[model samples]
Target chain A: MPRTRPNLLERQRRRLVVPFLLPALLLYALFMLYPAFTTFYVALTEWNGVSAPEWVGVDNFTRLTDDSLFSSTITNTIVFTVLGALVLFPGAMFFGYVTQRLPLGRLYRFLILAPVALSVTTAALLWKFLADPNFGAVQKVLRAVGLDSLASVELLGRPNTAMLMVVLATVWHGIGLWMMFFAAAAERVPAELKEAATLDGASSFQVFRHVVWPLMWEVTRTLLILWMIQGLQTFAFIIAMTNGGPLRATEVIGTYLYKVAFASSEFGYAAAIAVVLFAAILVLTLLSQRLTRRESEQY
Target chain B: MNRRSLLRATAVATAVMLSLTACITSSDDGDEPETESSGGGDASGAPAEITGDLEVVSFYPEGSPDFERLSGLAEAFEAQHDGVDVTLTFGGGQDVPQIEARWRADDPPDVNYGFLDVTLPDGGPWVAAGDTMNLQPAMEQPLEGYDGTWEEAILPGVRPLISVGDDIYGAPESVTTLQFFYNEAIFDELGIEVPETFDDLIAAADTIKAAGIAPFTVTGTFLPYMQVYWDYLALRHFGLDGLQQAIAGEAELASLPGAQEAAADLEALVADGNFLDGFRGVDFTSAQMSFFQGDAAMILMGSWLIGEMAAAIPADFQTGTFAFPTVDGGSGDQDGLFGGTNAQVVAAKGQNPDAAEAWLQFIADPANQTAYVESTGGISAYTGIPAPEGFEDVTAMLEEGAAFAPSYMGVLALSQEVQTAYQQPIAQLFFGEIDGATMLTQMSEGLQAAAG
Candidate 1:
């Protein structure tokens, strides 16, 4: 086909597209693409943020293979994702389903999401104090229930429980958003299908398991992938609460990288860790997308 | 609730909290001494050339007394030179990261805070990296308060920390040491004498424990404090040379002759269960709270603890400071103190070298350094200053001929990666997950890899 000049309207729209999209593209390129590519180059060198970078090829990545700290962070990150998914998805779905149909649903939703209003540090501190062994609410409650010995068991002090405490705080801070996500998806479900199932003598659990659950499945899968990403990149709670301590039992990729870069000043090494993390997240997310892909059900 | 009742309840709650807080925090005798109206007064001796915009950064957060003290110094420097505008930036725990960012951009800050210790493998990080200027000249230069040079004015033990051979890279502001801060009332109540030896200390700890009080409070969360038990043990057992042998990769700490005994001593310390419950996860701040709140009878803390926790100390709480007791059969200098110096390091490639150097020299003046000690509650690096208020005993202790070794735990001069990797196994050792020998082996192996 011979090229032809665009009509006036088309020409005007094409001119508008550049004006509209150029700023966004420029910003994304500057803040994201530039740094991303720079980080790749940095990962190949031994740079201490301040000094000129010395090229070290694949040494950093090679070192990571046997690095105990790197392996622990990777393990902990995976644990965070798996444990978080186990607690978050089911709990979110259950509450989201119940809240949508329950009386005073808005109030329930508001109460459930109240923690979201608190900053991560505030929420972490709140949870930390609440679990204090001596004067915390957990101790008071445990003592009230005659679990006196257990009351003094420091939840955040021990290695296993410290990590668990961080995870719990993260979940408390985040569960609300995921719950609201499921709630919105449930709201979109056709009322007729639920009514039909109830009339067909389906118990509430049965109705949920067969009807509502299947309806929310698409949202569930999408949110699961989202939660996994959040879990992988978790940082603030660990820093504010445990600081990757109690024998570094709570360390994850994000916190480790931050320490490596900022504390140790090994920006090059940290960049290597970051590049690997980015690659892993991208590959996993794509794989998740493929694995979760399904034909949409026509109503 | 009714509005009237709500208001009444709020007032009552606030009053209760106020009283409770007062009963908990030690009396802050006074706010910081007023800055001289004469704009830093007459500089004891103004440097010949100090006219420029001097940019200084500190880890002390703004509004903190330490930050205010430093700000006062900068203002003083500015006053000395009409043309100089001293701008001080505070980052609390982030000064280094910020400095590095500025350095990467090729516009480094003129002066910033840092740790300067000879114990660092190559005279600390910036000096090792050659990013800091040699501060020996600033130290050797005459200042108003001293009969001789500023170098002679500094504590003999601390003078070596900033030097790598002939070069000095840090202008130190304070001497830091770890000591036991105990509740005086508890010690008196038990008729327990202040322990001068490790055995006596252990006995006192037992007595305190028998009274159902936590004998000590130390946080496992702060990796530095977590290493203290091992640090003192290693020093006492192996002496400075033997301890340095491990740090320098010449030997494993566990392989030393005194290693077994020191391990036993640590095992005893750990086995005693003298520390407050849940100490592992709680940070240094909480550990301090546990002590000042009277939950723990004693706490081994750095010199900054008093100032850091001044507000939390109750007026009635008699905070007693004592040096770490001497170890029996110890080869290390019994009177030796383990600490580091906080310095204001000028960048080698900074824009205003003269201003920064002069600012540092101004800081080194005896009167100025004395002001720092008097204003901020810490051990001053410069000599001839009275101890900080409430730290008189500590000052007297240092005056009695003690050696000072910069803390060697996290300041290993190794990469943070290696230090963190090394610390994990040590933490595991202290947690009873690994034996002392295993810890030494792991640490040695970890450092050996980095060394390679």
Candidate 2:
């Protein structure tokens, strides 16, 4: 006889796996994959999401070049991304080291991640209250300390200051998650390398600069890529807090896209804006991935 | 691994299936079942007894005290109606796109809030596409108890907004107009008389500035404050109809002499340093509080500010209201009041159109209108309804010279794209970043693009 077929029990077990996996796969396909693909398709059309779409054939893309707001938003996104990378990357690495090495390290780490657990909405509201020009807690404190002008100035009402405040708030709220990641990565660094550096009379700083950083580069590069992508998608903080106001000083690509899509109902224009942001992030992510590969290969 | 385990697995699987089945089945019949009774003896006698569950939607934002009162009213209505239940859904704030989307959906809300500018550029498509009900029949029907407000004394300018070529769409809920709310104490301290003309306003600003207080306070948050400049100047220069004509596309903004003067007048206000430094960053809440804290002497705000101003100030805080200062020698005589009313209309496709109409009739009563006005700090559109308590001083200003001109700018003719486009240019004017003529040019171009 040919190879004996599996028993009914085995056959039934194999069939059981399909049913178990199918629902989750089907849900993912329906909710995530389908919508994402449709969004891509819509991006290429001149549709307002109300009536039937007109085929503009990249006219939206052409229009975006001359649009002052689009260009400004792109600039803001780059600025926000750079600022986040500079602050979050090194700041997290430093904090992770300090928490791991310093006294009361556990308590400090707990405090650091507190904001991370707090919703961005809550954080935005809290900071807005603090930054209020009239009766904010921050203003009151600053006034008591003889910094009356700073207290009186509407921090989020001005242009450059509003942009700065947005970046500062975002960095503060986001640094904790990166710190947590760095701490874990730092902990996983070979104890042998650390001990070897110590035997050679290397100071803590030197040990970190030479051994720890290289080992953690893999993790940092990975995180940097993720943060870069997240940074481009920044919306809630700017929208909830600033609303891209005081003459569009703080309008980011994400917020600009949202205003065009939902507020103005110019879905096609918004899609074009989104495609530009998506392309930028995609390029940055791929470039970072390549850099990470080269760095990993060196070891 | 074994038959015993297999049996347990099937048992668990069957339990999961049963639980899911129960959830799906239960959810499918969430709405209460209505037993239709035919032509029974009812007071409003029509065909079938009105009994059904309704899913209603409106653009009223959640945190308002009015929303809670309305919800309470719905519950009371349900209790009185016996078998009828109403479920309400609220809409987004500061944006109407979400509300419009619901209107265009396959199953729209039973009712919705429509902007007075029903014939917007982008809106034309939807109206043409049949997203909205014609509403002529419902609007023209003499709302039983609403006759007093609906008939005579309704603001003349406001009537046009509710009608399109003689077909009424909605009724008014509240009427608002621009007025100067001033701190009498500050005026007394500075020995400055309240301004009666644009020149006087400029002079008062100088006097107030000399007294070490900001002359004017305007909210930088909402577009209303920025638009007030245009409104005040337009009325003072060419009048409401002149601006209305420009907004209605009857007159080109670039060619209108009144439009030019209005722009120039606003430019003067910015050049005079009447507002606080970087006032563009200062939001409405802050601007409002600034007056209460005695940081500013006067604010150009709507009648709604009368209540808000009273609530924010000290218990004994005294404030006064006056009509916006007229340009003494303007080209046109325009009334300086900006006011309109909101009407509730039933959707044509609504399952319980009659019931919705019934609710509208109930609320249309002056007795109910008074209660709503009291709860919401709004003026009942009904002429017979007396103004609420503590609205005395403001009402006096209204009695003196209140002309009800509905907001007919972006909402009336401009698209959402054009509305947003105006925001930046208008903001720039407030900051002395752009002149009025340039602003008007940009607005005209934006409108033309929308037209295309």
Candidate 3:
């Protein structure tokens, strides 16, 4: 095909591109790309954070085949991400649509978002204290209701209970931000469409399923990807609450790699884990982008 | 855009990333605080006439007594040298990474705490990297504060901690040991004798439990707290050398002599419900709080626990100590001390080696170490110094015939990775989710993988 050369306006625009684009590209490469490439290189070496890095190509990667810990690590990461999506997305969507039509809507919004404002450590610690087996509010409430059996549940010791509490805290701390996105997206879906559907005897559930779902899919996809990325790399909540304990029940890639790097001084192996994490995130993001592809609904 | 313009932009981006990379990573271009020079001449200080700017750094938080003591030492060194200026840097809690970043740039503090397990937390990695100065020559000569050479001044068991081969990397300041700290009121109420052997200890725990109190409490959230349980047991079981060889894979871990009995002893304590409920979830501070609040009768902790928990202790709380109970029929020394030494290290490429050495010499003086022990509420490495007033029990355990051992888990002079692997299975083992044989096998395998 014969290429059409740019005219005066296009040429002038192209001339300004290098100077304007250089700074951002440099920043992106330095902070993002450089570290990423470094991780890939380091993964092939056997380096402690202190000593010189020794090349041990594919050794760190191959260890995943037999590393029982990595299997649990993957399961834990997926549970957090998948469970978080189930709770956060639906809850956010419900609240997003409900609050604007309710009295004291602004107050409700503020209250839900309050957990988000607090630091991650603060929020996790609050949850930990509440779930503390002895004298915590969770046990106190269970006992107050006279359900003694449930009161005996050790919130953090058992594998399932520990992960359950962590996920609950994560959802409580996270949903508010997504709710804001949903509320905004819901607002953009013209009221007349819901009203017409209601007048035609469609149920609220049907209206939401058919109308709101399509309009909000774009935002939802992005949120899901963000949740996946955040979930796979969860470190703070596990470290702060359980420290990957009850015998590695809640270990995730982020926490595991941190232990390998700082605790074991196996920086090279840590870097390898980091590389795999990066690849997983990239694949999931791309897959989500592809699966969510659709024609834009022009409201 | 034309192809040439697009190519040009890519080249520009690459150049920017390349050219500014060094500038971004550089640790210093005059970021260090200007040296607060005392102008050493004619000042009333030591006779040393060293002339240079020295940087001394510590990882202690500002306003901590440790940091204050260090600054005081730095001030004294400045006064003594007359010609040298010393800058003391406090890392607040982020000191290790901050110091390492500097070292990566080939610039580290002139003198620093090595972060030894016995002497300082987070100590070995720097020494393993060969970043610290070797103190052998200095150890050979007489230091003014002690009657003997520097090496002789330090208690015998401590030197091996910071040593790599024949070269010693850190200067020992003080040491500590582990003993049972009992709530005297509780013991008196329950009529429990101070436990002298494993049987007596078990009986004491049973008595305490019968009285509706948790007999013992430990930080389940912190692995080292649980892992420390194995230290005395394994020490008494395999004895010191055997346990060491077992951990190092020189001896068969499974066939170690006292293994079965010690394992039963450990599992029985938990199975009998002798610990606080939900102990595994309780953190260090929480466990200590439980002990302090008198919810638990006793806590197995280090000698430093007193100083660490000083602020939290109640005014009328009567705390008493006894050596960790000896295991009957064990091959190890019955009165072996369970503790480690703490030390300060010098950077290999410090600006003024002589001044750094002089500063350390001043620190090593029996007077300063004595002061450290007094203010820090711990035992000094300097031999002649008397044990701090309340630490007579710890000192008595340090008697000539008594054996000394660092914590098997916490300050074991092993990599944290290997230590963590050994500790991770303890929760399962303690919860009775895994048996003794399984635990030992898992631990050996874990150690191999960690070491690999």
Clashing pairs in 2: A157-B281, B117-B411, B117-B412, B171-B343, B172-B341, B173-B341, B173-B342, B176-B338
Candidate 1's C-alpha lDDT?
0.75
Off by over 4 Å in 3: A135-137, A140-148, B1-95, B109-111, B115-125, B141-144, B349-376, B396-403, B409-421, B444-452
Question: Worst ten-residue run, lDDT, model 3 chain A?
Answer: A257-266
Cα lDDT of model 3 by residue, B395-431, tens digit:
5545342436766534334554466567776677876
Which is better, 1 or 2, measured by TM-score? 1
Instruction: Please provide, for model 2 over B1-452, each residue's C-alpha lDDT reduced to its tens digit, 9 standing for 90 to 100.
Output: 56866887677656655555464346323342232333342223233355776655644546555566678878877876777778777854544666666554444555556633444433344444444455555554455554532433344444554555665555555555566789888888788887888888888898888878888888665666777777667766777666665554555666766677777777777676788654665667778888878888888776666544444678656677766777866876644466555655455445565565556555666667778667556665555567654445434444444545554343423334555555567777886777888987876666555444
What DockQ results for candidate 3? 0.42
- Of models 1 and 2, which has the larger DockQ? 2
Tens digits of per-residue lDDT for model 3, A99-181: 87789987898889888998999988898888876747998899999988988777787777888888888889988988898
Model 1, range B272-382, lDDT digits (tens) per residue?
677888777567778889999999998888888877776778989887787778889977667666777777777766767667767776777778767667555778776
**TM-score-sorted candidate list, best first:** 3, 1, 2
Q: State which candidate has the highest lDDT.
A: 1
Q: In model 2, how large is the Cα lDDT of residue A16?
A: 85
Off by over 4 Å in 1: A1-16, B1-54, B68-88, B115-125, B128-130, B348-362, B365-368, B388-403, B411-413, B434-452
By lDDT, rank the candidates, best first.
1, 3, 2
Question: What C-alpha lDDT, on a 0 to 100 scale, does residue B201 get in candidate 1?
Answer: 86
